[model samples]
Structure formats: C-alpha cells, structure tokens
Target: MSKMIFINLPVTDLDASTRFYKALGASRNPQFSNENAACMMLCDTIGVMILTHGYYRTFTSRTIADARATSQMLLALTVEARADVDRLVGAGVTAGGRADPNPPQDHGFMWSRSVEDPDGHVWEIFWMDPAAAAGDTTGVDA
Candidate 1:
C-alpha cells in the first residue's frame, strides 16, 4: 500500500510552533518551514504542514477555531508501544504542552493518551495490538 503522508495544521505563531515541535523531537523542514508556513517532519514519509493563521484561512471559508479553547481536528499518531505514548506526553509537558486529565482511553485492543501543545493542538498518542484489535487475541501489552 502507498504510505500515508502529511497533515496540515494552522498555527498562530510560526516561530513558537517551530520551537514547540522541536521540543517534541520533530525537526522543522527548512525547505517549507518559513514566514508563511513550516513543515514539521514526523518521519521520513510523514509530515505536518503548519501554516500561519492568515495563510491557513485562505484555504477555508469557515471561521478558525481557537486552538487553545477549541479544536478543529483530532490527530492520532501511532507510537511504537505503550511506553512511547507516555514518553511523548511527558516530553510534551516539559516542552510547555499540557496533558489532558481525562483523556486516557483503554479498550481490549487499543490504548491511548493525549497532550495538547501550547497552540491547543491535540496530539493523541496511541498503541494498537493488531491481534487484539482483530479479536484474535485476548492478551494486551498492559
């Protein structure tokens, strides 16, 4: 299958967003991250295009949601394992992000936690055991 790639988000402050994602271990794509937009590299194949509010608004007609007080999108990023979910959240906290108090979710096969960046973008870190997810297994990592 073709690899899934790219997500575009709106940021109020490009510089701040650049610094924020950097703290989460994502590098700014110099080629794209600039005065108008910034490309945050999530992986070799995956990236998030962050555009300034004005630039982002040009593509949509609806009013922009206040990222900190509201949410326009929910982004779930898969992690290597359960520990990775926590690790990412912890890293977010140290970098000025906030972990949602009531957002932990656990099902027999799927587990997730989330944190919000200063810009109020929600990042859901999740882990899914395919065998369990498919109902073929009962054992969960945790």
Candidate 2:
C-alpha cells in the first residue's frame, strides 16, 4: 500500500473549513469524517483533517496555537507549471482565503505564491521546471 500523509489542523468551524478546502479542489472523505471533524483529501496521497479545537485537544497535550497569530509551519503543494501555481492561489483567494501572506517567489526555474486559509494556515503553491529540479541546466533557462 502507498503511504499517505494526513495533516491534522484545529479549526473553529468545521463546516467552513470543509467548504474552503472543497473550493480549493479537495474532496471530502465521508468514511473518516464526522460532526466534529472532516477529512479533506487534497489528492490520493495527501489529506487534511480539520477538527474542532475541543476534538483536536483530545489527541495531544500540547496547546493548539492560534494560526492567525503564530507561524507554525508552511505547507507547500507543487504543480505542473507556473500557471497552475497562480491558478491554485487565485482559487484559494476566491474561496475566502488571503492571498500572498508570504512574498511571491520567482527564481527563473521556479515560481511560488502563498495563500492563507480563514484560520490562517498558510499554503505555498509552487511550480518548478522538471529539468531544473533534476539539476540539468542544459538548454533550460535559469
């Protein structure tokens, strides 16, 4: 079986968060979702579990940081092309997310932009040339 990643997040409103993810193209997995939590599948291998603060607390003893005020981690998703990166970020913004919480990055071979969900979780959308990523600069513009 292929390994999968499930990023668990604390959300104040499960329905809103679920809607936000759906707008960003993630589908809900009903089998693993309930009233207190929703499992949003970003892809076959990546999932985001949005849980209410009370339910999230049951999993760990650590405090749940308010993402709006604190920088926990930057989640990144790669796309096939630069246009795709922009499209995803734009879709996020149209879905009630904030655009470019972090400055946009354009390094010739790679491009990236960020968007913040309503709860302030940052998602970096990026694209990198396959040749450049493989360290092959021949014929590929830097």
Candidate 3:
C-alpha cells in the first residue's frame, strides 16, 4: 500500500477552520470527521486533521504552542503553475486568512507565496519550472 500523510493541527475554532480549509480546495471527509475533529482531504495522498485544542492536547503531553507566536513548521504544497499558487493564496486571503509577512519569493525558476490561516497555521503555495530548476540555462540571465 502507498503511504499517506496526515498533518494534524490544533484549531481554536473548528467551524472556521473547516471553512478555511474548504476555501483552499480541500473537502471534508465525512468518514473521518466528527464534532471535535474534521478530516480534510487536500488530495488523494495527503490529508489534514483539524482537531479542537482540547482534543489535540490528548495526542501530546507538551503544551500546544500558539502557531502565531512561534513557528513550529511550514506546510508547503507544490502546484502545477504559478497562477495556481496565486489562486490558492487569494482564496485563503478572502477566507479571512493573512498573507505571509514576508514578501512573495520569485526565484525565476520557482515562485512561492504563503498564507496563514485564521489559526495562524502557514501554508506555502509554490510552482517551479523543471528545466530551470534542473540547471538547464535556457533563458536564465545568470
């Protein structure tokens, strides 16, 4: 069987978190969802489990850190095109999310932007040209 990855996050507001994820093109998987937690499908192989703070604490003994106050990790998703990166971030912003404090990155070959959800969880959307990234100096100046 292929290995699947699930990124679990603690959320203060379950309903709002659900909406935020849905806006990012993820759908709630009813089979793994309940009142306290929602299983969001980002794609076939990846999922996100958004659990209430109370429930999330059960999984860890350490205190749950506020994502807004500290950076634990950054979740990134590679997209098909630069426009797709923009579209996702745009939807996130419209859904009451904030754009990354840092400016968007444009590395000629790769373009990336980040958006923070209402819970302050950061999601990076990026796209890269294979040829450019592979050192195929086609149109690069340097």
lDDT of each: 0.80, 0.91, 0.90
lDDT of 1 by residue, 27-131 (tens): 887987669998888778878888888999999988878877776778888887777888888888888788973469987477799888768899888888867
TM-score of 1: 0.81
- How do the residues 1-142 of candidate 2 rate in per-residue lDDT, one tens digit apiece? 8999999999998888887888778999999999999999999999999999999999999999989899989999888878998888888888888999999998888999999987999999899989888999877766
Total clashing pairs for each candidate: 1, 0, 0
| Candidate 3 lDDT score relative to the true structure | 0.90
lDDT per residue, candidate 3, 1-142, as tens digits? 7789999999999999999899899999999999999999999989999999999989999899889999999899888888998898999898878986447998878899999988999999899887877879788655
User: Candidate 2, TM-score vs. the true structure?
Assistant: 0.94
lDDT: worst 10-residue window of model 2: 133-142
Best candidate, TM-score-wise?
Answer: 2
The alpha-carbon deviation from the true structure for residue 22 of candidate 2, after best TM-score superposition, in angstroms, is 1.5
Instruction: Please give each candidate's TM-score.
Output: 0.81, 0.94, 0.93
Best by lDDT: 2
The TM-score, computed over Cα atoms with residue i paired to residue i, of candidate 3 is 0.93
